[model samples]
Target: MPKVSRIIPILENLLFFWLGLALVLSLAGDSLNIPSLLQVLGRAHPLILHFPIVLLLMAVAMLWIKDEKIKEIGTWVLLLGANLTGLTVLAGLLLANEDYDGAMLFWHQWLGVASLGLSVLIYFYRDKSSSFLKISTGALAVAIVLTGHFGADLTHGENFLLTPIQSNEEEFVALDDAEVFQHMVKPILEAKCISCHKEGKVKGELRMDDLAGLQKGGKNGPFVVPGDLKESLLIQRIHLPEDSKEHMPPKNKAQLTDEELEILQLWVESGSSFEQKVTELESEEPLFQLASNKFSNQKSYTFDAASDSDISELNNFFRKVNPVFPGSPALEVAYYGTSAFDPTSLKDLKSIKEQVVKMNLNRMPLESVDLSFLRDFQNLEELQMNFTGVTPNQLSNLEGLENLRNLAISGNSLGAEAVSVLEKLTQVKKIFLWNSGLDESSKENLRKALTTAHIDFGFDGKGIIYALNPPKITFDKELFQDSMELVLSHPIRTAEIRYTLDGTEPDSISSPVYTAPIWLKKTAQIRAKAFAADWTGSLTVSDLLFKSGIQPESYRLAFEPNTKYKAKGAASLFDGIKGKTGHGSGNWLGFKDTSMELEIFIAENTSPNEISISLLLNEIAYIFPPENVEIWTGNQQGWQKLPNTDNAQSTKIEEVRFGMLTFPLPETDFDKVKIRLRPISKLPAWHPGAGAKGWVFVDEILLN
Candidate 1:
């Protein structure tokens, strides 16, 4: 009781001081130059405000307790709540000195002060009648709730609470009909830039919620200058280093994606017109391709959905019958595994012919199968028979497909006879007859006959030299106990696979031609490329094969991975499942601005010679290799530090790639191994996110 008496007086004095400070700060408003220390303390308002909300709500609930001992405890709770409420209101007042405005902020500030004042009143009148205390506490609770609601609106944008129930359904706009600004540029801004620059919390006096405000600009100039990217404020900010104060979005906010940035640049370059339709731009322009990709051309189908049981029954290992998209009635049937394909597989889809809008028989053995089964699919819009052994006679079966808009018969041995059958299909807008034994003269005749349809005789390999795709490299295992077989093959059978054993680029003349799988006895870096007689040499593709001397029994991570890219948890590192290039593929363990520390437990009598960590680098996405890596081997008694490796910081943006960091370990027996990976503390000055922490992504860790 004596301790409570002393604390209450001190708390009351502190509460009075906070109340006065808050009033002064609130009155000072935007005119006040908040100190650096005060700004840091103000930012902690979000963290501290929650405590008072929970405590004050609990204190209000306690007013109903009839027990004398509980009532005595309620007094202490009310005093603590009042003191905290004053502090919270003061913090909020200081935070409001930032670029916060609008009705939401206005209401949140007043209501927070009202709640604090009411809490103090409730504390002072604790000895009053139960009814009076209950009434006062109830009003204070209502004020707190309102204050929190508006505060949320200020921080998370308007209607944050109602967002879950709100419909986010996007209207499907056709590619040709989509407006350049409304359909493309507006959406990008809404997703990446609008949250911070919206009405209530305009970061730089720039309101991006509407077009007029964008034209008005912020403290700078206009947001965009049509046909002048150099003068455009939006482009300038977007191109600025991510850590720059003038950047469109702060480093902490979601940045503009590569595609989005490209689109904006193209839009400005093409004269940023708000009313320009996608078709207004030249068809060959890059903006048109981007717009075509951004907007869906799919028309709503009127056909009834196929029965689930029928779809399920039709789907097999070789044949797949599924909707083109979720909740779509239109079905797309694809045939895979040429050996398992049967003529009956095509006939089996008769039950749902009306719903089958697209059919892909690419590379299937269609010589024996009757393609006449396709005539039954009256609603079919696209039919692909690429390299499917389709004959000129088989092409006649597609004549009656009135709804067919796209027809692909690439790699077929079709002649002039097939052109006649195609000319009859008047509804077909696009016809792909690439490598379909139709001579240039016949293709020209077909193009003349079908004036409305586009006859694409793809890539006449005459004078133009095309580069061969990189050879596909595969290994039996990346982390092997003794040796691993590395196989290299190219898609074009005529192309020769050239590779290098060392970490040098493979050349057509000097590199060894790959025939049989190469057996790698130790850790090696393989670089391979495809080379053909006429085609240009392909870009080099590389992979690191690690030789493991010891396999760890178990492993543990010091920190949990980022929630967005946790993959399969800590087990993912040793699971031998290498993540693809993209981080969103759910294979890589992503850490943002944090070091990765892993401990591996080795079995008895296994002394590993090396440790290899595979890392992903996508500089444009801000994912970089580790700045430095440290390795430690130890038992229960002590630990020994191994020679560490440091990575040179990248200066230019590169394509998404994978790199291996190998650490040579001393030949000493140890039961445990600890690896520490420190990500780049700050991105390079040449990079967009200069001065911001880079990301480190890892999928596999090998102990050799």
Candidate 2:
């Protein structure tokens, strides 16, 4: 036994030497990558730290022991405590340099080192300095307590033990008086970010402890930008993948809750203000809910459990009975269909009599007296019997359901007398009585009877303007050689449709009235809208009509149309019958931002006096007019550029157009001709999608 005692002191000195070596190695943590074996061993610090605390506590109690046998055992325990303390400190320093922030590491590490030194001091000087042993043991116990507390704080959160003991009686600021950045955003950053981002332990050279530090940002950039949440680094880091090294709070630290993330997003979205009240924002904003929760005094309730057999029997094909939540006693009952309702089937639900909390019997054939069975459901909180045969006399049956919060009995024979009985429920919050044979005076009287409950009797049809459906463009053929017939009609029959032909939206008064079919000779636009008396104007509809000039003998395209929009064959372009007005029509050929190049061969070589190119324009459909048009004729001078040609012009009019331009041919004979139409690279600034490339829609290239 004494040989074991002599070996332990040598072991203690070796452990102390190892602890100093590990402390020195940890200083180079920034440059050195710990070996896999040492990293695994270093992780045991948390599990091994408690050993020294418990052993040293037991040794400290032995300082007052009078028995020689116990004293001898105490000496061995104290020596072992000193030995273990050195090993624990070595492991802790290695773990700290691995991933832990060093802001709070100084105090915890030094206190642990002090405890190890005192353990050795008390062991060697217990007999020589009795007074010194007592003082060192007392100091070591307090150091162990504080070291454990700071270790817990690092693992959990700062002052975690005091969090639950915090008083709830403290007054909270209202949403109207609270500052958005100060009250809502700062606390979240302090809890989840400040540990790594503060002064001494700035992991990314960022500090979130103060506004200036946050705005000054890190090596990357500013943590938050006033109005741009997506550009803000604070938001960018939080939304990063959890396994990512850049993710905030690190994977090992405490992560922000969903509500906390939303609060930060809302704060940055609201200009990252320091003094703006949450209530000052729009009511639909999420900040109002976050701020309100800070002052809410809401509570949750528990219910009794229901039997499993009773739950199974109460549920059937015609009715459904299920718990509000998992393992909750509160159950909701709803009927499947109106015809599936059987009065006798109500007896089957008697098994779950006390567990049922809600009953939905809407659109059922329930009679007034059928509700008498509701007396068995004392726990019922909501009863929906809309469009049922419930009469005014049956309203008394629901008085026993004191827990009822909502009663929807619309489309029934209920009146003021029936509503009078519900005022006694006290807990009832809302009574929906839409179209229950209640007059305006009866509804006003019911509202007076129950000040707490809201009585809804629907609304009178007054001052309401119903929207009219968009007018439909009716036509036989939009593409024609000479002319085409275009008609505009509304389904309302009596609605008057006004139209335009110059690629402009039609007005109710100034635009031409569409009483008959419009004759379109040249390629033109047809825009129309419907209007009716006592109704809002309908949406405008536009159609394009391209005039087919001389048909080509043979033609070839440069690129194939997208498969989704390739409606008709290439010959459909020269069919003389115009394509349908809408882009969905098979006759219309769609091309992306690229140019449409076409080579035409005149079967009979002749002198063509005139040449015209037809194209479609509808910016709302992302189809813009060509940027430029080029035409070439194959002559004795082989593929010569045609001079002085008119190009199709684009309009700022927010409507559809079938544009055509004619280029006169000189006294020259040509067997082959080529045409190129370049689509607009980018849409005009007037368009909603201004910066995007515009599509080119064309059905035919007319030649004469």
Best-fitting candidate, scored by lDDT: 1
lDDT of 1 by residue, 458-563 (tens): 8767798999888888887666768778888887999999898756898889889998999998777799999898889998988877665455899899988887
Clashing pairs in 1: 242-688, 610-704
Clash pairs for candidate 2: 479-578
Error of 1 at 457 (Å): 5.0
Residue-level lDDT of model 2, residues 467-562, one tens digit each, is 798898977666666777887777799999998887688888898888888888776667889998998898787776666666667888777765
lDDT of each: 0.81, 0.72
Q: What is the TM-score of each candidate against the true structure?
A: 0.51, 0.40
